[model samples]
Target: MQQESYSQDANISPNNYQLSTPTKEKKQNKTNQSTTIQSPNNNDFYSPKNVNPWKTPKSLLKSNQKQTTPDHSQQASPYGDRYIPLNVSRNLFNKQIQPFEIEEENAYEELLSENVLEIDENKHSSILNFNKQKPEKLQTNKQLENPKRKIDTLPIKVLDAPGLDDDFYQDILHWGKNNLIAIGLQRSVYLYSVDTSKVFQLTQRFNNQVNQIQYTSLQWNANGQILAMGSYDGQLKLWDYNKNAYTGTMNMSSKRISTISWANSNIFAYGSKDKTIHICDIRVPTYSVFQLHGHTQEVCGVTFDGNELQLASGGNDNRVFIWQLRGGNTYADSQYVSWEIKSHKAAIRALAWNPNSSGILATGGGNQDKTIKIHSSLTNTEINSVNCDSQVCKLRFSKIINELVSTHGYEKNQICLWQYPTMKKIHQLEGHSERVLYLSASPDESTILTGSGDETLKFWKIFPSQISNNMSSLLTMCEIR
Candidate 1:
């Protein structure tokens, strides 16, 4: 037989060679073995001739993986790692978990303080578990428990104050340190006892005088023993209420004395319609110690600072002046006039000095101006101002808090409580049928009394009481006894 095309090596065995013609399957196996030999790796079935030149190595690898891996598209999870729809999540959460029970809308808004939902994906179905959490308390509700809460909007007490003057330019009401309130009603001055709730006349009505003497202003000494009354007939009268005796009466001005203030228990100051301020020592009833001339019209208001070193005066000329209390006879010296403010468009009838702050003064304008201005006597400039939208009749500062209470006239006839520096209106009280013209605070500063032209006096509890534990216990002990 013809020798087969075998290796011409001496190591070849004749039994391993196919001596006859190769079968069809054997021929195909030879072709496949020849294609595999073209590649560098004998285990790699992909050869250069079998793979397309345009296809990358990554494509060939993916084709091989697809042929080996089984398809699981028909058996996939219903949930996914991505976010579920809001509606579907809500339904699932409602069915799986119970939410917190909130009593208020604010509490509901603060509910679910944390995202406590935890998912377990090891099981066939997704399970969401919610943990319980405490909702935070509302700030507004906690603030209501404060000791210094908001004041009541209504008055605690009311009384008829008939014959009270309706003038917006006069200060006819004052509360003394002895718990006594003095109010000028036309030609008479009456004292009301806060403890006894009794009313007594301080001055009798005089019918024999040529011109009827109507009481214009009232003020009390620091000791609350002597009260100073100004009259329309230009007279200044002092009375010792404890003794029920008249101290003295003198003609301090030729015009009506519209206002009066005490620097101490002895040194006194009064303003008149003659456009002058008279500062005199009560010890000497003969003459005034100093005469201040600044305003061109009636001097309707006058106040002394807490230290008795400066005096503030306002008038119908729309001018406010701060005078230094030096040994001087007149403020015309120019050096004695510490500050002069003409920021008001109408007459200024209200003036007050901050009891806690020296050189800080507050002045209120009349009907046409309807504004309150705060001034610094030390800097000789206006510190702040607020438009009241109504006639500012009077102003009183709280001794315990940094608050200012103002009485209004002409339309609304309301009383407003304002926070100092910021000048924010804290509360507004309305009860008077006519213009609210007079304002005064109790000795403890826990209450304020407002006198209106409608002949009504309303008492409002404006500040919290500052009572010590010992005092409260003593009061309780006395009540029990």
Candidate 2:
């Protein structure tokens, strides 16, 4: 696996194979009994770079860029004594592509939510919304507070295989306090510790095709960290990451569990491909606590509001459902609670809500055009939209300054920042030549981290407040000149 650092185009779609030349090629046609030669603009699909034969790294990189368990075949911890068997996925797309690897195509092929409103529960539905505060402009002395790259933290290896397509497409990374995890094709889950800079595997085999992963840990019930994996197999598995052991696994449906989110720690909600959201109680250790069935299509993403309470789900049914954690004692006193909401145009892929804004929800558009749309979950309404580099693959809200972190589809690799109402481009976090897969914002909102097909995770600190001193000094120096 060769290691390379490349910049990403923030906004680009998966199907749109961007070659060196235009894809609009003219063709000879007889439309009205007249022969005409079409132009050459339709050549975007067959990227000339595909034929460059330079996809490999300049240097023949060795696979041992990062240290790992020597076997390479497979591994398990001491818990190996007990192995709970679950249904293995047999999908062609999932079985063929191995993890930590990639096989780029010829580069010719381009690939390509919600509800609301009104009175009667049966008739028409309405949404609630509100605009947000305008952000300040970019001050001087940007170098120190805002360094362009964090080379010290970026991964140096490249994982190659078929589904991985490009390394940049695999950049979206997730981390829990001490570890960073990359969610990839098949059941491929790679874990990296920020503390040690070492990487390892979480699951040898995926429940089916690994789509997304959400980490949850609540001190009230279990001290162990639980990972809710939404798989193409239409099942969800909860594994204790700290123990490196599988705790519980269930087949939610035959389709994928599009998204999973932790309500707190013991309580988590999962949206499914079958257009349903199931809220499970980790404490119960027996059955699902509650379920919301309103969306008619596949449920895409799920998130829990801050303050440790509400549940929000987005789906292909074009609807977003909101559920609150009521304190009243239920029949079983379980972690189940209940709520509802508005609709979307196409299927909803990823969603994020502002913890500081009292339910200000930012929904990123999926499907064809990746537009970032914002709405107030409290008062449902279309507030505004942010134009991304390409079709968006994922979007998240920063916990501190209320900023947003968004990752577009494979073709677009750069992560850009936008200040509030003014909608200004604050900074361009560059570096990641392949498709970005997973991304995460630190709890304090000062750092942004990402993982990609390049087989590594990188971290960047948001130079806003703490680094204000250096920026302030630069502004003064410019005035004297």
Candidate 3:
């Protein structure tokens, strides 16, 4: 009745509203509209169960906590079960997550919970061994070799020589192989024994002569039985210290015999101021066997090689000559002069042949030059040279090592030890107060004797005594005079 009254009052059109819809149908349509309004469009909405598993779980949780409901909360309350917050769902969908961290944590936990296998130590000891090996130590040659130390700076023995000459060109002191020292004091030759510490005047008979000749040079033969004394009068006096007798005296030259060097037990050579070199044999006590003339000034230095096969001579004429031993008249006109060197600017006096090397010679220059030159006589070439800084008075090769010991004069009256081939100076000794004029080594070459104008004879231990058996045998076989 109420529906008919409202239709008549509004001038109801019965054709348009043919039949009234049911109340149940109208309520169903109203519920559908409310559901559509509460839920968002399908394109913008997402379900929690269908969310990407790769997204960071912490971001999704934070977005969900930050999300707020709209002011129409009561309207959407009935369909809240099917609805999801747009911010939370969109953040979880848009974000990227690192899967490795989660996987690593899972793997570590799995490893900690895993069960490890066990084995009996005695049953598999060899296969499960963990011992380390210890290596053996090695020894070096330096550790096994002899213990050698540096030489002392002071002389082991010092002696007084009241009348020793200070002349640079003359050699007046020599050490014989028998351990005796033959030293000339002014006009007399004295013999000093190393063992007994005794001195004897060998030229006692010459004390009576009015015109006593001064000793210029002294050398002992290879046998160590005869001592040859050179004088300013050109006399080559021979003496035997063991017998205390004068063996003989030969007139070798007209001027002073400045230096003498023995070649063998019976043969020797001497240089004189007459600028000549003479080789003599003991059998002919009055004459020389071979004569050599090359120097224009006084011959001050002469030495035979290691094997006594060749002779090297240095002269005041600044010349050096190497001669080969040959018998006169053996060949019709054969020359004994093998080579000559004029490398020195001043007089050349100091000369020494390397006892260990063949054809190796060391020559030193005088005050004007002040240099040491090494030469190879085999190749006829100058090997090396060094400035001595002072006058080179004498040079001698060391027997225990391949070295050269030199004495200096003028300024810096000192002795120097040089390493051979390289010509490097090793040590310098300064005990002399004046010019050092003489140098002679002991029989073993472990010690050297030096004489200076200060009237003192000093002994220095220059070489080591730890000599090899081969070197000892060689020294015994060769004279080294």
Candidate 4:
């Protein structure tokens, strides 16, 4: 229950992730994949049962052992009951947040366990929804503040923070804030902490959310820890965190920082409402990377090439401009290296880089233009664009599968999957009731987590086996490329 605090950066943990035992995919013979043990039946008087099976399943056993393995543990002690003793599941998550909550002392009671979320795997046509049981409400912090603030499940699983007031909310997103001991949010970034089951110490925030709040760009570093937030108010802030403390601060721009990204290392870049893109060093903000002109309107999103040598900027003007770092780490040599085919008809809302492919990119927009397009960073051509029902709210690339996942803002609130180069709709991830403002996936590509304005943060499992159009076709067509 103790909350830990840190005053500096060296002490930051990776946040909430821990490595599991290494697993190798080397191919093995089917026989090598498994083995069955047989037990003699007691009625037959010749069979001796192997009471415990290690990693072997009952279904896979030979018919001989089936008769002898069960019906005899009735009078046995607890250990004799085929019990799988529990071990703390510490290595289970790559990154997680302590459930954000609003405390109300004895006024609040626990929500029932029967309430569980159900998921439907298809995007464009499946119907899956949250079980609608309301939980006992909290009496403080939130306006749902009165004891009636109702929650329908375990209090630990509360989705949205209490909407009662600004202070009632947990504006913080700690990597390991709640339970695990050593982790949580340092700034706005997620980090690894020891145990999330316990409360985590939170760093004092950078001035709470201000009115006139609007941002054109927000980015997570490749590690997914640090976040650069640029606002329309012409102010840029960098939030550095772990479960411990705020590390440092840098002043980015005065032209209402339009777009921002961690180009590489401590190197950073920002496109502004000022109609120019500014490249600067994180360690030294005064050192300018030089500003370049291209967009006639506000630059909405910016992404850096894998080499950090190029920057891609997109805006409401319906264009994408690729800028190159003239020499070394400095952008003082910045120039419009290339441009993509006129991609969006409306303001671009999101742009993301593919970590595995240096020459690939994706961009999203804000309207019926809900289309997301993929571009060859190398050829600077439109490989293809996806058609969506609404504005593309958020975009993510899986480093593991090398596929793309995007959330269509108000359009569907559904998650859609796209294969790498083909840009074809693979499967639709349908869930979440509101606009998803933030979405993240594990570096290993296991799960997808999204934060929605519906006032709840929902975590989703992206099954590797989801039916893909191409995968389903192979069985019927028997065509191999």
Best by lDDT: 3
Can you list the residue pairs that collide in candidate 1? none
Write one digit per residue (lDDT tens) for candidate 1, span 1-481.
0122323465543223212233456444433332211222221233333322223445458675543332325322212335467999788868867688967555433443323433233544334535468668767855674445777888899989888878865778999999999988768888899899999987777777766678888999888989988887788888897899877887858988888899888888999999888888878857367777778899988888888898888888998988888765463557678778989999888888988687789999988999999988878888999999999888888877788999898777999988888889988998898999888888888999899999989999988788657766876889954
Q: Please write out the lDDT profile of model 2 over residues 1-481, one tens digit for every residue.
A: 0011111553544323222211345332233122211112332112222222223322324443532222413323223336555545435536677576546743333221122222353655446434476667766797655455332233333333323323211222455544444444444555655557666776555466445443221111122276666566666666776677878877657765656667666887777667777778877866487666667887767787776667667766656666566664344422332334443455556677775578677776554545677776566566787667465556777654546777655457777666654556666666776655456754445666665566555667653434256655866888865
Regions of model 4 farther than 4 Å from truth: 1-158, 162-232, 239-248, 255-259, 285-287, 328-334, 463-481
Global Cα RMSD, each model? 16.4, 42.7, 21.6, 32.4
Candidate 4: how many backbone clashes?
40
Q: What is the lDDT of residue 439 in candidate 2?
A: 64
lDDT computed for candidate 1: 0.78
After superposition, the stretches of candidate 1 with alpha carbons farther than 4 Å from their true spots are 1-148, 206-211, 285-287, 327-333, 467-481
Query: What TM value does model 2 have?
Result: 0.54
- In candidate 2, position 176 carries an lDDT of 56
Runs off by more than 4 Å, candidate 2? 1-173, 180-186, 205-224, 325-344, 410-413, 430-437, 453-456, 463-481
Lowest summed lDDT across 10 adjacent residues in model 3 is found at 37-46
Native-to-model Cα distance after best TM-score fit, residue 360 in candidate 4, in Å: 1.4
CA lDDT of each candidate?
A: 0.78, 0.54, 0.79, 0.54
Residue-by-residue lDDT tens digits, candidate 3, 54-73: 23445456565543333432
Q: Write the per-residue lDDT of candidate 4 for residues 253-310, one digit (tens) a residue.
A: 5566655667655777777776777776666636365667777887766778777767
